[model samples]
Target: MPGIGPLLGAEFLAATSGDMSLFGSADRLATYAGPAPTPHDSGRVSGNLHRPTRYHRGLQRVFYMSAMSSIHFCPESRRFYQRKRSEGKRHTQAVLALARRRVNVLWALLRDGRRFEPAQPATGTA
Candidate 1:
């Protein structure tokens, strides 16, 4: 929500058909959006993951663009992106990870009908 603008928001709504019920869960939505990789494992070739072959590119673009914009506008997003980079992820991979996380948040918000609220930093008292 922090990174989503008018156009991206409209695109997301159109992609999702304005109904969370169709997805049933955030994982499902992510899969549809192409952020959730599919396994290409066979016997000894385990841990092999690849992009899904059939996903809504428009939806993926919506999430990817929002994730990229969030890195500059949202502190939490920046930190997450930095952490992913530290963990050996490339820029695109980090952004995709953030996008997947955002999908979960968006799904929860839609399911609960709540607004996005940034977490408050904790203060230490002497």
Candidate 2:
């Protein structure tokens, strides 16, 4: 029953490029918008990690759609998609990885005024 105001509610739709970029990248924006997935990985498998919690449906839709959209619109994200696919990860599986990775990038972008950059391979840190 709360957040009924247009500003506080779901009435806001992006109207321009500037408005969209204001969130830095989709992941941070999705996180702020809410509904980002709760990653549940212990070793290899992901996506179907845990039972769904009491999260806002609207927020989840926002993040999911935004992640999918970025796959088409965001160049860096698209490259990640291809890379994940090349690594033998399935489509949805790769997307979930991207979403989880986006959460961290988004958090950082929101904290600092930088855009999301894909991580480079580590040098013998393993």
Candidate 3:
């Protein structure tokens, strides 16, 4: 929600048909949005993953753009992106991971009927 603007929000609603019940879960929504990679394993080639082909590109674009924008405006998003980079993921991969995470967040918000709230930093008392 932090990165979602009016246009992105509209696009997301359009892509998802404004029915969270259709998705049932965040994983299903991510799969539809193309951020959840699928296994491409062969006989001896396990552990390989690839982007799904039969997904909604518009939805994917909405998530990707929102995730990219969030990196600049959201501290939580920036830290997640930075951590992914530190783990040796490329920019696109890191962004995709962030997008997947955001899908979960969005799904939970919709399911719970609540607005987004940034986490408060923990304080240490002497």
Candidate 4:
């Protein structure tokens, strides 16, 4: 667990390591990552968006586990968590959003068959 952090984890990579062809594209990646929420109709009531995986538990666990660490070890993740809290999102909601964001980035990488782009330093008036 040394130097290992969330928002990216061994689990995520292992879950995604097989069959790039199975993903097909980035949008499909979104769906696979549990970011693509489902239509929740509550018996003549409105709907909501959330995860529901009867199948991809390992994959979901990857994101969730990563999320758990990201809040503690990642600056950007911490910032996002703070921002979401300020915006009135509950702690879980904030974390879920962060996980989905990471999923999108991973999706882009998968789409291009490329490794992750390193975190670029912020450029400002120096």
lDDT of 3 by residue, 68-118 (tens): 999999999999999999999999989999999999999999999999999
Which ranges in model 2 have alpha carbons more than 4 Å from their true place? 1-50, 113-126
lDDT score, candidate 3, position 28: 90
Q: What is the lDDT of residue 33 in candidate 3?
A: 87
Report the lDDT tens digits of candidate 4 across residue range 1-126: 211345345666677786667787755655676655678878877776556654466776676667668788777777877999899999888878877776667667666778755467698977
TM-score of each: 0.88, 0.49, 0.88, 0.67
lDDT of 1 at 46: 94
Model 2 TM-score is 0.49
Stretches of candidate 3 above 4 Å error?
35-50
Model 2 over residues 69-123: C-alpha lDDT tens digits?
6788777778888999999999987876666665556456546778556567569
lDDT of 2 at 71: 86
Clashing pairs in 1: none
- Tell me, by lDDT, which candidate is best: 3
Q: RMSD of candidate 4 to the true fold? A: 4.1
Each candidate's lDDT (Cα)? Answer: 0.91, 0.57, 0.92, 0.68
Give all candidate RMSDs, comma-separated: 2.1, 10.9, 2.0, 4.1
